[model samples]
Target chain A: MPQIGGAPSGDGLQAVAMAIRILEYLAEQRGGIGVTALARALGTTKSRVHRHLRTLVETGYIVQSPESEKYRVGSRLVTLGRTVAENFDLSALAREEMRALRDTLGQSVVISRVEVTGAVVLATLPGREAIEIAVKPGSILPPHCTAQGKLGLAHAEPAVRERVLLSRLDMRTPHTITSPTVLREELARILERGWAVAPSESLLGVNALAAPIFEGGGGMVGAIAILGSIQFIEAEPSALQIRHLRQAAARISAQLGDVGRDGVDSLPR
Target chain B: MPQIGGAPSGDGLQAVAMAIRILEYLAEQRGGIGVTALARALGTTKSRVHRHLRTLVETGYIVQSPESEKYRVGSRLVTLGRTVAENFDLSALAREEMRALRDTLGQSVVISRVEVTGAVVLATLPGREAIEIAVKPGSILPPHCTAQGKLGLAHAEPAVRERVLLSRLDMRTPHTITSPTVLREELARILERGWAVAPSESLLGVNALAAPIFEGGGGMVGAIAILGSIQFIEAEPSALQIRHLRQAAARISAQLGDVGRDGVDSLPR
Candidate 1:
């Protein structure tokens, strides 16, 4: 028999798990899901799923169609999501800075944050030209591969970094950094140099440079990166552009209340 | 005593409600919330809240600082929200058409959708000039006070439109369509004319014109609108710009699989 609230039995704890599972399933489906389908997917009885559905509907986390009785993720979640996205102070502070970077460097600029599980693209400003690389906001990049991920890992606490290294790093490209020892050493070098670079590491022919943004409390809040075609970024002398990106990252860090001395020594050679 | 899981008494159901309550509380708090504060706000026992917190942590819906034990909404939600925002066909179709309209009329473009509880701005493209009025994506607007809202209501199902009329109409400015009867009549005219216009409806001296984006099925998905200072929109000969806006809206509607040839005769005078 399945564990029905045995060791997991607590004050409404099971309900919370069910709700999250329901939301996750809805999120995965994208389209609205019917009650029966949801129940089958969750491996629960229809009555149990129906009870949870009613709660979700009443709470505005999911909406039930009047005609079809299908349930979809609700608009309240969108409102809540907006609030959370805006909570990353780095996004707000980097907005104008990223725009300037795009204008100056003529390349797409993206700001990303490292959460416990992975790295999420927070904001992206496309380059002025129509043919530039586009990294849509909200795209998740593997923590062991992308430039932003390396930058984030470089700044993460030692324990957290080790845990991440221990996890499987699914290689996305032929050039992706896969070995944990190599990745660990690369992260160390990133920390020492104050920036990270991914040359065709995440996607082939896409070059990216990233620097970490620190909060006032000294924790790395996120990373600011500039991305473009290898042909463009490599062919052009990018010392000035790299300096501008670093300066912009520093400004964002300052806005997050990071008042550290200018760490010019951190820029990757 | 509160009605604790009055209708849905299953353990899983209750757990879902508690987790939603916790998220709602965190959203309101903006900054990371402590377990004690969340429990007090949610009017539940600390131990119960802690259990929910642990579940959220495991599911990646939330994360707590190792040092502080303070919890914040997780990046998983951000990734999910981005998917929703991007996959919103209405917004995607509107963005390209809005860019075209902005280029043609040199006015800011906005696409809005009516949510269950409120109106949401889904996408926005600012005009080339600094004199234009711009709405940011994810901004909320009152239904009875914006042109996009009026267009949405004009094209909504009869029952929903009636409910909106029965609801309170928040008066944002003197020009807001506040009276239910008058607003209903206005919607009728807009339906007849195939478009809607609001002169200083939500903001003083800001004029807006919008057309609905019809889905393949009969229902309206969203509305695309152009906003400008009254003096600017009126100063130009409006027939050409209005024609362009209608054509742009039609293009987006067609992209959404709206094959109806009812034409621009449905616009309001």
Candidate 2:
């Protein structure tokens, strides 16, 4: 939206610039990079490049071999990649459960993570019926108009909730919430009820129900939601369906909550 | 080893330090980081930290969310991690093949990538026997003493081979190639034979046979080798064993060679 970078903010900015230049150079080369090569490529002095590389090594952005001293990307960078890619999203952990939920309800299932801008669907499973709504993975949905979005907004921390609602609520369909007051009322109900239902809010004749996915750290991470034509799924779910959906969501949340604490994705030796 | 980064050498060094400091701070936060928070954590001025943040975002060392403008690690760092972790090693892709190779031969299998200094074993599958040789993943093997190491050296680019040969050839056992001339002769023979074997060079009564793993890019990325006690495998492989090992290595090399070109793990959709 607004211009973010480019102005010289301080001495630290120059350091950040050089460090990034080195990384950009390293990214181009698949093999290990040397200080001389980086300096030559960036049109700088070798000694200068070497000093920067040493600092990068200390911070774990650049790793140097014990014998060769050749630098490559560090394991920490990979750790960060996993963070950005998943962002506390638990689709891989909830994949099987999402499929099971879809089969049980015979409705389309969607798991989405609420981002600063909007809700991003991480994964989805189709309904038992041949005809089903297919939400592409990575597709974005308005926070005020979908079951997954409602669950996300409902469970988000107050700061995030307030910021997300600051913008005008563009209606996706006739049933979509256009008033901040009404949406806030629904969110309160969702927090108390532990789930949210949006009937024909995203698209006409479509209804969706969702449950919040929580992390072990006591934060709402995403949502496990199911939607279908009003003929199959209405605004409210059957007691049994609600239990199954919430149970699956809760189970996935529990499993993911212990990720870093229990070493869920750590190296297996 | 030499007290790497506490002392800065030049103006460029300061840039490197600031960039790395930002990365280290970013690693500590799971959510998003703003310029103001980063400056406070590092005890630097906010304007300076903002400048550094801009450089990181530009180089992909840090990512800025369009909606939040909060910085985190970018996707490119993940790409770099894959390169450093498994770029030259096919163990993960060849996992099933390695298992099959072991099952068929009833011996332990080791996969290693040969770097400038030595060979680093990426993965291993224990043999069928109760007393199978155990080679830990990430174990380093001397180039002069291992079948995988020799295979790597024999096929390496001339510059690397020359450099490795220049290093002292320490004798591991009486059978190890302590003389550079003799090792060169064996390497020449290995080039002709498409494989290499080292008998009792590493241990008193163990033998290993290795074949070079070739990527689609025409580089010998690593070696796939099988080893066991002298009683089971002996000093050299039988023609049948050689054929099986080569085929397995070739299959894995083919599968992984297209990674950089095909863009397989770029980002999960």
Taking all chains together, each candidate's TM-score versus the true structure is 0.46, 0.39
**Candidate number achieving the greatest TM-score relative to the actual structure:** 1
- The DockQ figures for the candidates are 0.13, 0.12
lDDT per residue for candidate 2 within B98-142, as digits (tens), equals 998998998899988766556788899899998978688888988
Per-residue accuracy of model 2 over A76-131 as CA lDDT, tens digit each: 45445544554433577678898888878888899987655567888888888777
Q: In model 2, where do residues sit more than 4 Å from their true spots? A: A5-12, A27-30, A65-69, A83-109, A112-269, B1-12, B60-70, B86-107, B112-269
Please state the error at residue B39 of candidate 1 in Å: 1.9
- Output the chain A TM-score of model 2: 0.65
- Alpha-carbon runs more than 4 Å astray in model 1: A1-12, A90-195, A198-221, A224-269, B1-12, B88-146, B149-196, B199-221, B224-269
Per-residue accuracy of model 1 over A111-206 as CA lDDT, tens digit each:
987765567898898887678797888888678888888887777668778999988888889988889999988988888777778888878898
Q: Give the range of the ten consecutive residues with the poorest summed lDDT in model 2 chain A.
A: A260-269
| lDDT (tens digit, per residue) of candidate 1 on B77-170 | 6656655654454675467677778888888888887654445888888877766578878887666777777877776668778898999898
- Quality class of the docking in candidate 1, CAPRI style: incorrect
